[model samples]
Target: MRLGECRQLRVKDMDVERRQILARDGRGQKDRITLLPEKAVTILR
Candidate 1:
């Protein structure tokens, strides 16, 4: 995800159980779902 997308992320965009991060309004003004690494998940929580 781009810096802008990351900045826009909220708790609602994260699914810790599924290990996913939803990147809204990404490149081309599109939405995408990306994997959330276990290491990152630990820190996020």
Candidate 2:
């Protein structure tokens, strides 16, 4: 994912239970979910 895409992610869009990140493009098209790494989750938390 791109830096801009990461920046666009909201806390509400995150699925902590599944440890995934739901993101969309700047245009709000093509939504996708990316699994977060354990280490990354720890840091984000």
**Which lDDT tens digits does candidate 2 get at residues 1-45?**
768878987888777778888878744567887887888778877
Candidate 2: count the clashes: 0
Top candidate (lDDT): 1
TM-score attained by model 2: 0.69
lDDT of each: 0.94, 0.79
Global local distance difference test of model 1:
0.94
Candidate 2, 11: how far from true, in Å? 0.5
Backbone clashes per model, in order? 0, 0
- C-alpha root-mean-square deviation, candidate 2: 2.3
| Per-model TM-score on C-alpha atoms | 0.85, 0.69
Q: Which sections of candidate 1 miss by over 4 Å? A: none
Residue 6 lDDT (model 1): 93
